[model samples]
Target: MLGAGLLPLGVLLFGALTDRLDANPIEHITHSTGKWAIRLLLLSLAVRPAQRWLGWSWALPLRRTLGLLAFTYACLHFLTWLVLDQFFDWEAILEDVAERRYITMGFAAFLCLVPLAITSTRSWIRRLGRRWISLHRLVYAAAVFAVIHYLWQVKADWLPPAIHAAILAALLAARFRFRTRPVSVAQSPGGS
Candidate 1:
């Protein structure tokens, strides 16, 4: 999980130091961060399905790790856009968030992630109890908003975003199917 989360950051740092981020460095950096954020978010969502369907016990801890990584990369992505692209122009940033559909969606998706990330601790889990699970379900909507943000932002090739959307659709479908299945003792949350 650490490798999965940190490899992109490592690659970005290496690329920046080596001058391998292409001509528009800021654009490249922002794009890399955003892509990794989305990819990590998707992978985090997959952990549970993988665990449930294949009985992979290790995947349980990976969910939280990947979720944190997703949030981290998302923060980097937004920061790159704000500091590098917009140069801390509050008015322009507000305008983009208000006027641009893609930006609005992206910002909304990030906002949704904020609370989830904040309440992801073991202490929060103990405090929230069953309500924690309900709150974390916001991930589904966050994923959808993220894909739409990506889709709307693309100008030329739509294949990548389309593929992401398709994958998300398949994952959600599988989740629905899994929910309909009978919960065995082995599959139940508190079951031994």
Candidate 2:
């Protein structure tokens, strides 16, 4: 699972080294990282539903790893925007965060992942106890914000973002449709 998680990062790094990215390399990197972040996040969210609907028990254990990888990619996406796109221009960064709707949504999604990544460790899991599950539910909102961010960023081509949004809606709907607790022991907040 770790190898699977790192494959996207590896491909990104290889593209950077080989000059295989698009003419606008910064945009390419940002899009790739952001896309992967959203993909992994959705995959993490699907784990429980997959276990419930598809009866794939193996899917449950990969949730945390997938979520962590999604967070890592989100961080990289933000850094690419900050360092490569804006060249560390704090003013521009702030302006984008404050004024640009897509940027604001993406930044909000990234902020939602920050605490989840920080508390992903076993020790932090034990420390946070039941509060952890409530906090991690933020992923649902983050995923929504991320899809909105993608939808807002596109100019003419809206198909990909729309598909992602549809998938996310289906996944969230499945959660409510199936009243069973999530398969992850760490995330079973209200289960008796």
Candidate 3:
């Protein structure tokens, strides 16, 4: 609800703040939306590790919401680039997607996220059961592609994307470690 409300608010705020938005308002909107998408994706990935390491189980409930928010922002990012930046020129956009390596990577990432978002509902979760988890693991791949997309687009500065990549790596690593760790005795009832 908050994210849905904030989308338009963000667009309005950006429009109000700058007349031209640094000479390329469309590009600025595209980049900003893409950056926020990556940030939300990273935040979604961090929830599990945070819950496990910090014992903040409440974070679990927000994971799906955050993932959906990431997808929302990703859709906004793609639409901004497609409609606003390319002016709905399908031919040109197709050419760019085919020719631009970064765009292809970002497109692939966006594609991966679609299924995950679709399956995020309780109905899909119940229907898929264990397979749901394996399917949603696509998030890891999506995060990698998103980071690569950011890295490829930014010519001079790599620090921000690199930081997001690092966080993703750490979160994935934590999941692997958590899975393999022996169950702690303290987790058992009546055990100290």
**Candidate closest to the true structure, highest TM-score:** 1
Candidate 1: worst 10 consecutive residues by lDDT? 1-10
Query: Residue 22: error of model 3 in Å?
Result: 2.6
Candidate 1 segments exceeding 4 Å error = 181-192
Give the per-residue lDDT digits (tens) of candidate 1, residues 1-192. 688579889999999999998899999998888888899899998988888779997888888889899999999999999999999999999999999999999999999899999999999999999999999999988899999999999999999999999999989998899878898999789999
Question: How much is the lDDT of residue 65 in candidate 3?
Answer: 86
Give the whole-model CA lDDT for all candidates, comma-separated. Answer: 0.92, 0.93, 0.86
1-192 in candidate 2: lDDT tens per residue? 889888988998999999998999999999999999999999999999889778999889899999999999999999999999999999999999999999999999999999999999999989999999898899999999999999999999899999999999999899777755446665578655
Give candidate 3's TM-score.
0.87
Candidate 3 residues 1-192, lDDT tens each?
456636753774678485746577778778878888898889889988888779999889888888988898899899988888899999999999999999998999999999999999999999999999999999989998999999888898889988887888888888889878877789767779
Task: After the best TM-score superposition of candidate 3, give how far the Cα of residue 150 lies from its true spot, in angstroms.
Answer: 0.5
The residue pairs that clash in candidate 3, if any, are none
- Report the lDDT of model 2 for residue 186: 59
Total backbone clashes of model 1?
A: 0
Better of 1 and 3 by lDDT: 1
